[model samples]
Target: MFEKFRKKSVVSESSQLETLREVLRRNPEDNDLAKVFPQVMPLSAVSSAWPGPIERLGDLPFGVSWALADPQNYFRYVSWDMSRKWEASGTNWRGLAMENLTELSRRYPYAGSKKGADGRPFVLSLLNEDSMGPSRLLVPGLFQDLFGDDYIVAIPERTCGVAYRNGLVGEEALLANDLIDGCFKVGTEPMSNERFDPKRFWVL
Candidate 1:
């Protein structure tokens, strides 16, 4: 019975993987590279088989990777094979990715400024309706306009990123740390507990 159950599990896994591959397969026009965007994720969340290279975010354990969004199927990582093809076609994938990401940010209407218990101001985007919470961290200029200088940023959960003004003090600072720790403790697809330096991301 044990062997039978193990075999069944393996088969189920294989079927699911195949279904994902099928969903990723696209025709020429459908393979528009302009749809590609940069995604921020913890190193642990990435698998060995994940296509394309993972660019480290400065000294942080998190990394920036590329993904293409399929309106019907959500999104998929850009495969090495596809990367090569795009390069051969003289496509600057990174530039394309950034352009798409910036445009997507314009469409994200869920984020706003909020005050902590101690009346400290911060900008928070939780569970972005577009489902690109952590990715928003890449848009430093946009958030910086709202947050100004002397602020810290955190991407605790996959769908949550916050930028707190005044560096790390008062109730807002404590709240940011608590949110990061709580997300990690609860295994809520946590990204990072460490405050992200947007400068590091700019180097990419």
Candidate 2:
């Protein structure tokens, strides 16, 4: 009788997990997840258990210097209006829109928009880190919402290899490199005298 009870408990738990996964898969933008599972908010729980290399402040210098020195490779022109903001911020390029994971999934379910030269499938996630943890739900949810039709679901990894075959870098490689060298420049102030001035340059 005890053995039967244990089996039933295991099945129930598995079913619950699957149900949660399905919900997240269908609704990546459900902010209510935090209410349902408060511990998953702020991403601290996931970050703590992340199985990636520890981030160090020293790494910032390399990424910052590289970006500052090579404006062409690092910067991309988004639009005339956005260029002004980028100039004001003293940055020429924008990193992948991490905050727009849900939108990206909604628009490009299989891969990123076809209008671009780089036809890579845009990666989406909630947790900013590239590691195995609870916060990892953000990525899987984004993937399911966006590319569920084309990609396979894999926990922890949160990316589908077959769906990303044409991408420039695999999800793991992107995570590893991004963790090692990527920097988030949101809401940072531009240094005095370092702001870009488009008015100073004329289009020939």
**lDDT to native, each model:** 0.64, 0.26
Q: Note the clash tally of each candidate.
A: 0, 3
- Model 1, 1-204: lDDT tens digits are 012112111234346446655655653324687778888876754555444656676677787788787666376777677788888999888888887887888677336556766664564644465567667667656566656655667776666666666565676667667655665555435566777665656644
- Which ranges in model 1 have alpha carbons more than 4 Å from their true place? 1-29, 45-48, 71-73, 109-112, 116-120
| Model 1: pairs clashing at backbone N, Cα or C within 3 Å | none
User: Model 2, range 1-204, lDDT digits (tens) per residue?
Assistant: 012112111234346435544543453232211111101111121222222111211211100100011112221112233334455877432222222333433444332221223543344322222111212223334344434434322112211111221233455446523421221211121111121111111110
Compute the lDDT of residue 15 as modeled in candidate 1.
67
**Candidate 2 worst ten-residue window by lDDT:** 60-69
Query: In candidate 1, how many Å is residue 204 off?
Result: 2.9
TM-score of every model versus the real structure:
0.75, 0.20
